[model samples]
Target chain A: MIVAEQKPLDEIRDLIADAGKVLVVGCGTCVTVCFAGGEKEAGILATSLRMASKLNGNAQDVTHLTVQRQCEWEYLDPIEEQIRQAEVVVSLGCGVGVQALAEHFPQAWVVPGLNTSFMGLPTEQGVWEERCAACGSCILGLTGGICPIARCAKQLLNGPCGGSQDGVCEVNAETPCAWQLIYDRLKAHDRLDLLMEIQPPKDWSTSRDGGPRRITREDLRLVAEQVE
Target chain B: MSAADQVPLQIVAYCCHYCAYAAADLAGVLRLRYPGEPKIVELPCTGRLDVLEVLHAFEHGADGVMVAGCLEGDCHFQVGNLNARRRVAMVKDLLNQIGLEPERIEMFNMSSAMASQFAAAAEEMTARVRTLGPNPLREESVS
Candidate 1:
């Protein structure tokens, strides 16, 4: 899920200070699952903003709306009229959702209310550790499901870097040595031999290195693009 | 605005049913004293306590908040307490960004057997909040 943390209240307050009408948009995808930017968050943000505005003696009109998935066009279609009416939009979604909203509504000033964090899973309840870097590769099979790309301090593909000590990353004692975790998992499975297989350096081309990328499937070809 | 006059801190306490909430109930049964100021919000599991709920509490009027859950691996739901720990950390970061004292929010992991622990936590959180005073959001209502 696209994990996002809320921006500072002062920053947010500043963003809408001059605006007369503000719309808080929430996404119902990765952010919703993380409880960062979702329907509930949108409502809470709207309430907080309203309260802040009231405190400042600058009462402003605020609206809250949540789409099924802000990253997708169809999901955002329902809120088009409302989106157009607002002078500014504060997206409580991930970076993608904010960008998608920006693209859809070029005339409105779009503001991001969240700082999109790394892609991760709820490792334990509220704790979400980065698990995938989306480096355009999958090596989980060799490392017992742990992605070194995200966990390893250096994203080491071959093995533990010199920074690892006593099975912990030097960067932070709380963080476990990703390579050590891999080694232990491999040893438990009696597949220690797989560690000897040298992994090729990750191909950066497939990742976010070269601007935005696209993946098209034959079955999912766009008919609109074909006509254009 | 006098230093002698402390702000009436608003605190939200999320009590897990099986552990923290049960412990709180036990405190009541024993007549164990704890702070009454912090509004208690009971939940089936701390895992069910969303970050937005915490934010909402702060937005409404909470000066500080804490989530009390079962000890690790002791949750009635097996992992709810653990999830609460992780969620609280993220919320702490969010709170920090929002100019609120991150220390205002915290999480405590304990079992039902720790009724004293629960009371102590409540007292401690209330004291911490007293030090922090009421949230700035409550200023409008105050004056």
Candidate 2:
């Protein structure tokens, strides 16, 4: 899931400094799970902005509403009236949600309330760790279900990268060396020979190097088009 | 007395049902006097405390807010107080960002048997908030 954290209150306040009416829009998907831009967070931020603005001798007309999924147009459509009413809309969503709101409502001024951090999961209570880079490819099968692209400090395909010490990355002592984890898991499964295969250099064309990626699923789209 | 002292600060205390609330009740039974300003909001456990609750208290013109729970390593639910403490810390950072003194909110740990500690926690928070004066946003919220 996409994980994000709220921007500092002061920075958020500055985003709507000129607006008389502000609306905080929350997304009910990935961000909600991470406790960043969920329904409760939207209300909290709206209240904070209200109180902060009042304390600073400004307008206090702030409100909040949450959409089922801010990345989808149908979910956002229901809140168009609310979006239209505000001079500024602060989206407590991931970067995608923020852009979706802006693109969906061309007239509404939208700003991000969260710093879109990464595609990750909560490893434990109140802790989130990055797990995927969406490199437009998948190589977990070759690396004991762990992607070196996301976990390795250097994204080395064939690695333990001399910096790996005692199964921990030298870049951040707290982080487990991805290559070490891969090696250990493979050895346990008696598939250590996979590592000796001398993998080819990763194809950069499938990742960010390929620029913004898109997929044309003709079957799904045709079904939707037919339903329309 | 100075005019600021007469501001009648309003403080909110979120007491856990298993410990702090019972201790507060015991304090009442013992006839131990504490500050009257702190309005208690009892929770099943301090672990149920959310960041928004603290923020709401401040937004509603609470001069100060406190969360009282079982002593560290002695929570009835094992780690409710610990969870509350971390949430309270986050609230402090939020308060700081909002330009309010972080001292306006605090977390206290005590067992249900500690009635005296409960009263003391109230008095401590009262004294601290009184020194800071009423929440600056109080007048703003009112008007």
Candidate 3:
């Protein structure tokens, strides 16, 4: 899921300004799962903004609403009424959700309430660690389910860099050596032979190389064109 | 309550429906008196308790808060009580980092049969809040 962290309270105050009506939109899927831009978080942010606005002497009407998935257009259509009424929309979602809202409502100003951190999962309660980079490729098969692109500080595909010390990255001892873990996992699987194959330089074209990539599934195509 | 007569503490209690809420009701039925300063909010399950919600409660006016859930392995929702417990710990760390006392937030696990335990927990939280005084958020509001 997309992981995000709430921006500091003081920063949020600057976004709303003296705007009288503001809509705080939350995503119920990824952000909610990660405990960042979820329905409950939206309510809290709205309430906090309201309290802060009151404190500043100029009251603002802040409404909180959550969509099933803020990245998709279909899920956000339900909030058209609220979005149209507000002077600005404060998105409590990740970067994707904020951009999607901006695209959906071109006239309304959109502000992000959470900092889009990374694609990750909760290792335990309240602890979300990075997991994927969406580099437009999959290398998990050879590395035992962990992606070097996201985990390794240097994104090294081969065995541990010379900087790895005592199973920790030299760049920062706090970070576990990502490649070290990959080497250990592959060794345990008895597939040391896989390491011998020099990984080709990653192709950047399929990723952010050619602007934003769009996928169309011809097999699951909607028949909306037939209605015309 | 007037500032002079006020208890100088405000607490928010998150009571789970299956156990803690029942215990609170039982406390009422048993006529076991406790501090009136603690405000109670009943939830479906402790697992549904979100850290943001707890922070929101505190930001509004709560000086201290407690998550009252079913005993471990006894939650109606299986592991919701445990989830709430974990979140309360995170909330405590976040609170402490922000200069609020870690003692301001707590988690109590008990079965519905433990009505006396609920009262005792309330008393304990109330006393702790008294020591900490009112929430800084409330202090800021008044000043």
Chain A only TM-scores, each candidate in turn = 0.94, 0.96, 0.93
After the best TM-score superposition of candidate 2, give how far the Cα of residue A57 lies from its true spot, in angstroms: 1.3
Q: List the residue pairs that clash in candidate 1.
A: A125-B83, A126-B83, A126-B86, A126-B87, A127-B86
Q: Deviation in angstroms for A80 in model 1?
A: 0.9
Name the weakest run of 10 consecutive residues (lDDT summed) in model 1 chain A.
A219-228
Tens-digit lDDT track of model 3 for A1-228: 888999986788788895899999999999999878888888877877775665466778998999999999999888888999999899998999999999988888999999999888888877989999888888888888768888898888776788899999888887889988888888888877888988987787877786798888977997566664
lDDT of 3 at B138: 69
Model 3, span B39-88: residue lDDT tens:
88999999989887787787677888988999999999999998998889
lDDT of 2 at A183: 92
| Candidate 2 stretches greater than 4 Å from native | A223-228, B140-143
**Each model's TM-score?**
0.67, 0.94, 0.72
User: Measured with DockQ on alpha carbons, how good is candidate 1?
Assistant: 0.25
Any residue pairs clashing in model 3, and if so which?
none
Q: Write the per-residue lDDT of candidate 2 for residues B1-143, one digit (tens) a residue.
A: 87667767788999999999999999999999998988999999999998887888788789999899998998888988899999899889878878799999999989998999999999999999988877877745232
lDDT of 3 at A182: 82
